[model samples]
Target: MTTTSVNQDKPLPGKPGVAPTFRWAILTLSLSMLLPALSTSIVNVALPSMAEGFSASFQQVQWIVLAYLLAISILIVGVGRLGDIAGRRRLLLAGIAVFTAATFLSGVAPTLWLLIAARAAQGLGAASMMALSMAFVAETVPPSRIGRAMGLLGTMSAVGTALGPSLGGVLIAGFGWRAIFFVTAPLGLLTFVLARRYLPADGPTQKVGRLGFDYVGMLLLALTLGAYLLAVTLEHGVFGTLSLALLLAAVVGLGLFVLVERRATSPLVRLANFRVPVLSAGLAMSAVVSTVMMTTLVVGPFHLSRALGVQTALIGLVMSAGPVVAALTGVPAGRMVDRLGAQRVVFVGLIGMVVGSISMSLVPVSFGIAGYVTSLVVITASYALFQTANNTTVMTGIRADQRGVISGMLNLSRNLGLLTGASVMGAVFAFASGATDITTAASADVATGTRWAFAVAAALITVALGVAVGSRNRSSSDRHD
Candidate 1:
């Protein structure tokens, strides 16, 4: 690459001796992250209310969440590529606009399907926002300041998570389910205005060609992701014929996507990103950690509601503990990453996850709420540690040019993990409890399922631990050699 090409990837330097643009830029990007992070947690409590409002089945109501995940996972890479070709600032502004509009649509959606569609659009917008924010922040801030900025972003995520369930409960109780969506509308608008006012404007983008983007590869990639998610959503312990067909379609679509990428002059995702040891290993660990974290997150409330006959209000209260602890831990974890390096910090985090998961798996029916809540705190704290360290590792390892798509890949691993956790844990729970309908099953059965699910979570976390340790050892060996 020429000097010009390399320089284009770097952030525009703040004017010397004037107001610090880096601080303002980090603030803008952090606020951008807050919206999507808030949205993810806030919507869960309102699902029941939404189901009641729309007179939808439990299974149908799940699409509200699944659709959002599917949309984000499928389009993130394509959108990130667009941001690379276009400008990150411009794409971020567009994302805010779309997200704000979609939030309004979600608030006013009359039918279940309409709400699902709106959520999907919202997810697309959220994807764009998330995919670029880290890259934008990292590029804008100086290398020395990167750790502090990442810590701040981690704090913002924790704040969003900490606030979500509590705020959702209040909104749902006071106004109705729609209020949950309505509250975020103004947040989106505020983010948009602040980002526009504060973010640095993009310079001229270098033109590639008449067909700058690999449209064929983009389409195939979308199909591949969409088909795989659909197959998971339709799974019935064992895959049904429809699920099997979808899975096969996903496999074929992936093959086609690879072929198209090889032929394309400008591909959506570069195969070379995976060659970076830290990037690849960090992403892999992220997926596994997310799988473990999300499995417990999904199953914990179920266990509480069923086994202990805990009320929804109490469950929400109990659920807030993890995020609150995570929020508190975020900055400290980032500092640790800065001091101890990502490998060592991530290793400790994975150990926490393993311990938490093992404790959860062993929780007896007689175990009180305190035990569950303690387990939650441990797992979430571990998440804070792992996420901050691993994210820093991935971002720092890649080139400035690769940051956009690497950000997308990071988020994609997470969403994929969430989907995997939900599906795998659900299937395991069902099989262990011998219940066809896991949701409305007997309390004893549900408790049994929760135990089995946490065992799986523990196993996943152990794998993450191995990955962390192996990477650390490899790096040390290389250094020694």
Candidate 2:
């Protein structure tokens, strides 16, 4: 298969055979993707150490993770819209600066609350980075190489996820839990510099107030999202009275947000944009597919230990297989998208996920760790393909002015799916095991739960597949007519 660099479509004015500008720009964007993804998983491994150092409970320590998620979930789309209005490159630099400073602050914080506050700050930076990086790809990379650029971003993200746990383990063992936060500071600094030098400046035409900034709409949307996220995550994804109240709040907030947006001169999200068949389908598929992937992470450890009797020390190692596959598959999958076309590749990827999900649900315990890994690799690798194609299609299809918000929306869907998966899928696993707590389930029951959860996962993927198919048909019919 043929591949091209970012400048192939339209060469930079300055250099010949030395696409230094393009290379540096790609590197900057790549680091932007990596930092946020790394932060998402890196802090997880340090939770125990943090609790011990802070003299805190599991619930409190968990806030270290949730605080970050809450900030990102609530503000990612807002920041994305803000980027479009303010300037993506400018905000991205500010974001990196915040993230880098917060990283060091987290390491040095004397109190647990201070550390959590730092993390929330880091999440603000992460929200900017993740929301703008994909949008920037359209700005920097040539249209022909968009797939590869998307793939590279995906690969960086996967690498960050795969690297976080093991790297955190080493850092904790060698230097303590604080080292995990400190280690990425220099990387952030380097990313900031490269971005400042390499990325194109926002054009004069892109200034704020063509429609005016939609403050009311943005705030209402953020509150709505925050409420929904809290509702799903409170009580570990189970719904209770408070959860019900939060859900109701989310519903009311959403209604108000829509009303506000309709009246605003400019809105954070264009409610009418959902009418585009591909965009709507892409968001729905992204959410559901992400939920299915979360099943593997949520249940893999319990299934490995309780069902297969794998040692505790090796559980993380075994669980790393999916990300390992994802890291390896990202670039190649992007190439496939460039060659095969995004829609076809998306359909194929969904089909692959369906097969893998079924295999995950049915692989007998007798077949052991290898069987589980094989099925997981299948699903994970297919996800790499689907994600690359889906992102490429969405990012490339939209108007240039709207890329930032759309990019944020994409990230928001992914994050919401992950949060939902942790709660909903975790509950499904426990229910299938007939155990109040999954950790205490018997070996056979754990195995049974693993199978049942993946069966549900398979159904979720099947639905995503249907969405892709139905959307494609509608899009085609609309075009032909």
Candidate 3:
């Protein structure tokens, strides 16, 4: 390559200084991360408004959210691999442009199905952004400061999740539902410009031993995940005949995926790489931790209103506390991972989760919002620590060429956890409450259900703790042997 081309492809200076170009590049990456998260969250508050606008039922309007999530879930791993083969910087810019245009379409679409289609297109763009943005961190930041970079991305994600509802409410109330989409469109455009101008150019694709992409594996896995998500999320988390059939298809698709991956010349995923202790453990614990985190979101609002008699209007305020804590703690947690090492920090984070979970299980309704919020703060803060530590450990531990796919896998695991928690945790809460219709259940019963559900959450985290410790010990033994 020419010297100019080489210079163009090189990432920022490895010193991790406060250079203007480097800062701008980070901002570009941050916006890429923020946009998808913002899309995921900002739309929820607008769902009712959208239903009214389209003259659609609530069930139909919900497809707006599901379609977006479904596309992203199915596309993430595939796009990540495509980025690896084609070029990260090139594909990311394309993703940004697509996302921006899709945002515009979402704002102006006259039909509900067209709006849903736009959201799915947005998801395709989001999958690229979500997968490759993390891969870029390793390229852009100094090796020593990667933890901080990961933490910043995590913070941006939390902020997006936290900021969405309030922002959407204001926009909808003032300018209508379309305004919510319109507001983010310009931000998306700015991200596209910054990325194209400031982010590093794509280097030549690295040729691994494998010469072709495994298209079949990608298809099968996408099908598997799509089916599983639909099964778990549909019908208000109720597992019925359709859910059963979907779950069956998911399992069968997974089996076929493994078989196809094992046979592929250039596998979409190298199945053997999973034997790497750190990577496997990290992904597993990420899913488990995410599941536990989702429990707070699923259970908290109900517990607040039903058990503590908090007004319906104020429930959102209480729910925001955990995400706020997560946003605040994300950067600091990343710094801690840098100084203390990921292994130690992982344990500390999980231990905090365990304590917080136990607290949630025991806090009496008599103690009110103060008690619930305090426990929640602990869980979320700990989650921030765990996420930062876990992500840094997983991403930095992998090979450069594999970073894109692994990042996808990592994010996919978290998504799966959230999906599982939304259904399974909700089920546990219902089962604990002993109510077929939780909305109509007695307050004391709801409180009892809260206790039991969190106790289950605590158990799940303990299992994750075991995974962390076991992985560490296994790594040590492997080295010694």
**Model 1 bad stretches (over 4 Å):** 1-21, 208-211, 236-238, 436-444, 473-481
Per-prediction TM-score, please?
Answer: 0.90, 0.96, 0.95
**How does candidate 3 fare on TM-score?**
0.95
Q: For residues 1-481, could you state the per-residue lDDT of candidate 1 as single tens digits?
A: 0111222334455333334345556667887788888887788878898888888888899889878878889999888778877877889999999999999999998889999999999999999998998878676765555555677787787798778877998999999989989999998998898777667776577653554788888889999999888887777436789888999999999888878877778888887666556777888998888878767667878888988789976887787788788888877887788778876778888889889888988977787798888888889898888898888888885666667888888889988887877776767877877787766889999888888888888888888777777777776776798
* Higher-scoring candidate on lDDT, 1 or 2: 2
Candidate 1: lDDT over CA atoms? 0.80
Query: For model 1, what is the alpha-carbon lDDT of residue 93?
Result: 96
lDDT of 2 at 68: 93
The local distance difference test score of each candidate is 0.80, 0.88, 0.89
Candidate topping TM-score = 2
Q: What is the lDDT of residue 406 in candidate 3?
A: 92
Regions more than 4 Å wrong, model 2: 1-20, 205-211
Q: What clash count goes with each model?
A: 0, 0, 0
Q: Show the colliding residue pairs in model 1.
A: none
